[model samples]
Target chain A: MTHEAGIPLGIRFKLLSDTPQDSAAQVVNEVVIGDYRDLDTLREFARGCDVITFDHEHVPTEHLRALEADGIPVRPGPDALVHAQDKGVMRARLDAIGVPCPRHRIVTDPQDVVRFAAEGDGFPVVLKTVRGGYDGKGVWVVESAEEAADPFRAGVPVLAEEKVDYVRELAANVVRSPHGQAVAYPVVESRQVNGVCDTVIAPAPGLDETLALQAEEMALRIAKELGVVGHLAVELFQTRDGRILVNELAMRPHNSGHWTQDGAITSQFANHVRAVLDLPLGDPRPRAEWTVMVNVLGGDYPDMYSAYLHCMARDPQLKIHMYGKDVKPGRKVGHVNTYGDDLDDVLERARHAAGYLRGTITE
Target chain B: MTHEAGIPLGIRFKLLSDTPQDSAAQVVNEVVIGDYRDLDTLREFARGCDVITFDHEHVPTEHLRALEADGIPVRPGPDALVHAQDKGVMRARLDAIGVPCPRHRIVTDPQDVVRFAAEGDGFPVVLKTVRGGYDGKGVWVVESAEEAADPFRAGVPVLAEEKVDYVRELAANVVRSPHGQAVAYPVVESRQVNGVCDTVIAPAPGLDETLALQAEEMALRIAKELGVVGHLAVELFQTRDGRILVNELAMRPHNSGHWTQDGAITSQFANHVRAVLDLPLGDPRPRAEWTVMVNVLGGDYPDMYSAYLHCMARDPQLKIHMYGKDVKPGRKVGHVNTYGDDLDDVLERARHAAGYLRGTITE
Candidate 1:
């Protein structure tokens, strides 16, 4: 949550902790002070920074409102940011904006869900809590009359969506600055597990050129419509018929963007700092023709270092980033990225390394 | 000089410095302790480290001999490293190994200066102090009888070499590990002012294929002959007609190899650490077709930050490395690197930024 009010300048900045090693890659010499909940303190911290940005969007809306009131810069201002902070807000905004979203109904009670399901797609719809859901937590799938009733007692904001049979999922990311200039990275197909991303392939190999353009344009449109001033990641599903349907929106650097750190001409992190600080957007072109990124999950393996060494020894070009974190089951720890002409050669080695890091080591 | 001891692993390896910065980029966690002049203390520090390496070659041979006696690993062991540490040792080894070196005469008294100037190539031969000279500090051009006497009077170990008319100055760097594994980065041409290197263009623009191959081969042969265990940067010159001649040897990371930091797949610094630790040799292949590196000399102008901002704003792709040194007139505080397909684009931008950092601000 403290990541929201991060300095719009500087690279590799992180909060200080006892073990700086196990913490995130610290950006040297960035200014981050004051409280997240207090608007006056946030305003004082935000003043004079060239561009205001976020690592993650969890800042209270009123705090951003206060920053805007005091004539300080805030990216994706409160109106656009609130949608990412609250799922109900996102669902309503997407609907009002005429974007194609999944057929779904919001429900406050078990009776409301039962009635919606009776009239809608009958089974196996995704039930998601409106807030605080990430990496498959705070989300569930319900198939029957008995299952839907259980979580409503906890008093959580819930929504049901028609679980379209997605041929594949894609993430379209575009970075915009306060100057209204935006650039999009190649749309990538993201493979997920239990609603958590596992791998991303840029250019979404064999994806229709028209669809890819649509996805990029849609992401750009969303960035402009929402008045987002930094990087915006739009998660989508390509149904069997190949229509790109909006699934979710992330207004900060996303998991799909990790490849840009090494694979692109300018890294998403560096460009994000440029954008929120209102600097001219850098070239978002890929350095190589293809770049594939894989997530390191703690779900499968206990000791990832053994796999990490093997990967480093095997492929000299594979760029490995292991966030200094205590690995736990199903936690997102780090990622491995590779870029080159031979996508299969790089992807195979990159995928093998990622699988190994995620405890999926096999013969 | 304790850089010869070894680097600690990991960025999070708190270096016990106020700002948590270390001398080497790769080595992170291990504590290294040593005083530059104390022979006995340096031996102890070298003995305790996981590996032995160097940032520069200034350690005395007798001290290295002492460490060798205590079973500490001194990469490019004393026998090989002395070729760089002492000029007499270098001329003898390269001559014995059948490498092309400038015709030279070693001298102690002022008398040898006049005789070599007449007997060798004539009035304009080069005079070099045998030890402890860097960045043109210990080198001088003795055009005639009068100019040659000052070097000998200063008690400097002087050597005279016939001055040759050269077309371009060049460098061929080879990296070798203890496991007998060696990798060579592409040979590069260096631009210098007053014998101080100003810029390096990798692949040595307009270099014929045979010359580049010859440069790489020569550096590799020298590395093998000397049993050099880390990087060996062999400076060279391509004569107007055809042949290439060896200029000098840098036993540590040479200025020319700085291109590898951003231009190559595996940086020379990371590779040097790998070699010293007997780890696998990484891919030393160039990432792009062309690579260029330019040193950021200290500016006459007072404001360093403003200079950095100006250069950064103009070219986002230029990779800037600041050494945390206070800017003084003509001091080397940092460098900027670039790589691209078009030689002109990379070269012009790199030189422009270098000029900006040096406070020249050219059109």
Candidate 2:
């Protein structure tokens, strides 16, 4: 958020856990974290805050219910959060709402998967551990019958999906306030590698205007249906048939909306603040005609600061952001945002900066 | 700067001075008053610096001369600063360069001024104290022959201008590096109250693009002629005859270019850092179609923070930059920069933020 504004744009952090004292020290005045296990601690922290929201849906349903009971305002309340937090619940709820989701089957053992895969509905079947799976973890692609054996005894509920070939991935982000006002940023196209986001291009180049509108409508429907308070990121798959399919959902600031940090009228962070605080939501229009954002994998550089400076001096428009973190390999350290009048111009800036951080000589 | 980008930007001050215990620790980093009195001390402190320039050009001319003498690199060297430092020299130089300037007669005595105003120019001549005047101070507008007595006896070197009829004042800021590369930001229409800049609108709405270009060209010519190092701000007047006249020159970062700090592709500070360091220049393009900057006067409010918060909440795009200072009437403590696709869009943002800071509301 700091790098996107090319200056410090304000985004206050609200930690729902007590383990972030060191991080709290970094921002002495702006943030207040609570001991999640202590209801009293959580209540005390939430009282004076302008808005009550979550980074993740880990807060107990009762705690959220209690906050709502006291009029303290738990954003996506327990009722809505349950649908987003549990994949099975989301599928059931979304299916009930007539939203298109991938065909899936729940199984407790390997025999059900074998029975499903041999029907030849697909060559490869995708197995997913429904809860607590992120990135590419907790997912498997099984080709034949023998390879799917471990899941029966893995002690995790398994969900199988038909492998569908799609054109690309798309994300539609909508910011909503308590007043029932919502604004949508441009649908962004994202590239994923090993289940981690690599880059996001705003406005989703080559996207049909009608389809884009449909995607936004879908995102807004889910946000309104679930009564999301801040931001909702609706991930979608753009199939070769020019259809968008529901992939997943995130109820807070998501990686897909990062491009808006620098490209749009109001960064997601600031807009999130506005929405949660019940301030008027800002225009979600893109400042530049086109913009792209790339996530920096920590393993890409030894000295992120020096490397970041090199990128900055080379292309002042390349807004590079480095999380104050120790770099390892393939960790999502931070990201860079770039914009221009054309997609090629903005995309080059994003790609080149990411390549520089990745030690590749990008064009 | 703290108030503008907000405290969230975290731009720390690094004070360089000599003497281990001088009174430099009040705000910024180590106020190491580097001994400019000695060459070794100067070089040691300046070593490995990204840019060696001035806060304001008050360094000994000989010191700059010596730096240039040793090929140590200096901008606007003694030669250029001399013109800015002396009123007589600037007038003479501007005249020699075939630029339009108000008719002027250098007067060392009171009787000489009265005689010149009476003979040809008539009544209502302006008297100015050369070299150290800013705001409305050190200047006098005389409507009659009897009004020149005080300055005539104060032993101040006074020069007189024809007081031409100017429709509006404008500023053209151009930056250049040692390699002779230069770029100019859009010309801005300036509004001044008591000779202190109150507001600036970028591209000067209704300004002729051709004429604005001509004004920019003239500023570039002066920058090249003066061998300006960092940035050169040219104060110009659009006369009734549709001709532009040069009024004043600033050799360092000037108030007029503050909008670029947030609205331009390359900020003036970042560009200055590049220029003084003799590095490759960044893009000087204006990202927004329109931008407005309003100076925040100190005395208008008892406290700036509350107003700042109000402004932030009202308009998230208002980039309020307050130079940490105590409030006093008519004092420039900070400025707010707002930009958008339309002139009115940004102008409204700038105006509301300023009005809030000034404790005034237009309903």
Candidate 3:
């Protein structure tokens, strides 16, 4: 998606991929197959590049710091990226900044997990690996100490938190440039199914205007405090009590902001590119009254291309974005975005298109 | 632009470029550097391709026929594409279809050119080579037989057209699928400077409602009549007396429709991809009340990237699309699309960005 956005800006991409068939590698004109963990590979990749950015925050922080020492510019540099890479660092930083967050503490073992949970909400708590976790992986929602043992088995330090009683999930997506220019997209409601983002509604349908502004301001503050460049997606939980707390932070373009591709005047991916290039940001305003995005998770059927005809015929305004990956069950192969005046219609159209593409809806 | 649109559709491109550094080749992943005019090269390039399509109409018609014989699906097939390749053939075909067109005839030489002019609105007649012309090339406006000799020097049949005393030039862009589904975009007024397209205003501001519809219907009819299986841009001369006459036909995505990239529900490039793929067509509705596109022609300044900060800061809603090409005098290196409820604002924003990018505007 960033590559797509970069083209119009005359930005040429030189991607480093683990495999030739990786979704992004399949489309990028210039690609280097290498292990990003190796400092030499990172140095070679950064040689002629004007600036280095990422779609994932998995690159080793030491290697990024090394690249910076070599006078190579890295967006969301080591310091800012470390927070996204380590949840413990993120929680501590957010706490220091007085940002609202769930009660969390670094746990040593199963006993420590129990102690951490009891300090807030008893029995049910969320245990997350401090680093290298994504899309529900390396995270556990445990009912008791016995169930909490799984997270500690990986030998990675675990951060246990009191899982808030949240009514819904929301995301505040913002972009920041090296020069400190920033723009905030409207807060959006992101719905997750089986720990994977399922749908997102821009302007968060019925969200209080004041609260939305607060979320936007908080996200902007987070971006600035972290010295982050490019995109910063603040995953938020709107609690049952009507207060919002930061649930997670992503230093790259997040799934929750995908709807901006068709819904907003300037897409998150486009703005991320602009931010990384240190160019002034574009407008983050939504183009429609309501916009809905639904993920098309891979299912038993691998041929999503065949379903395009039917889905498009049903809703001509449907915007489908496929990742150019071979479909596998539960994999995120693509997503569909729909926008219009009516939220119900937009939601149904997006859902129907996504379902059809996943081969879950025959009609 | 089409390659960018194809990415979200998961369409992998196999480009046949004349050089490795061609603008499209710079972005397309798989490129075969070879002369497209060579039958053997074309055949080799089509070996693994499921379908053959073009960004231009220069490939020999016979070569396309050969590809079709090889079971390769060539969208806007030879028969349909010939109209865009040859002006004389296009004029004859449109006339036979009862479509409104300027009075024209094939001229054998300078004497015939004068005789052809006498048959219409005499001298200062527009003369164009039957084939191979773009961006104001292969065309001439001759005042007399002495000046008409220049066109005959090409050794190709020259098409003599009555230079209509038109109020303005307009373009109606439409897309069609192989399955016969078609959609028409609102008519747009195209402003040309020195025979090169300078600016475009979507829906042709203040145009008569009936005339706009007529123009759209005419474009749709022409697409159907020509069996055009992708985007067809019907260029028209809106006469001083308020009648539209067919000026030209372009089978591929045209410059006039560039505004659709940021202003319409689905861009012409995207719809063209869907049409060529035989997928259901997308909507051609405008997302804004008024959209304006201005071409960024290359000038003495070769660096357009440096102007991004100024242009983007000036108009956050501005959408800049730069082609990956070396800047050369009078060449189209990029374009700016600006849209809003107010036409004048949109026009000014688009023109300003384009001018800045072209280094024609300092502030």
TM-score of each: 0.84, 0.72, 0.99
| C-alpha lDDT values of all predictions | 0.74, 0.72, 0.92
- Candidate 1, RMSD to the unseen true structure: 4.9
Candidate 1 residue lDDT tens string, B1-363: 112112111223222222234333222233444454577668655654555566667878888888788888778788888889878778878899888887887965556777887786677878888887788877888777777777776675787887867898999988898878889898888999877789999888888898888889999899988999988899897887788888788888888898887788877876776677676667889999999999888878756666666776687677776665567888887778888999999999999988987879744
Distance from true position, residue B46, model 2, in Å?
7.8
**Candidate 2 RMSD to the real structure:** 6.8
Instruction: Write down the worst ten-residue block by lDDT for model 2 chain A.
Output: A2-11
Query: Candidate 1 chain B — worst ten consecutive residues by lDDT sum?
Result: B1-10
lDDT over C-alpha atoms for residue B50 of model 2? 41
Compare candidates 1 and 3 on lDDT and give the better one. 3
- lDDT value, candidate 1, whole model: 0.74
Winner by DockQ: 3
DockQ ranking of the models? 3, 1, 2
| DockQ for all models | 0.21, 0.12, 0.89
Which one is best on lDDT?
3
Reference-based lDDT, residue A312, model 2: 62
- lDDT string for model 3 (B45-108, tens) is 9998978899999999999999999999999999999999999999999999999998888889
- Against the correct fold, how does model 3 do in TM-score? 0.99
User: Is model 3 an incorrect, acceptable, medium or high docking prediction?
Assistant: high
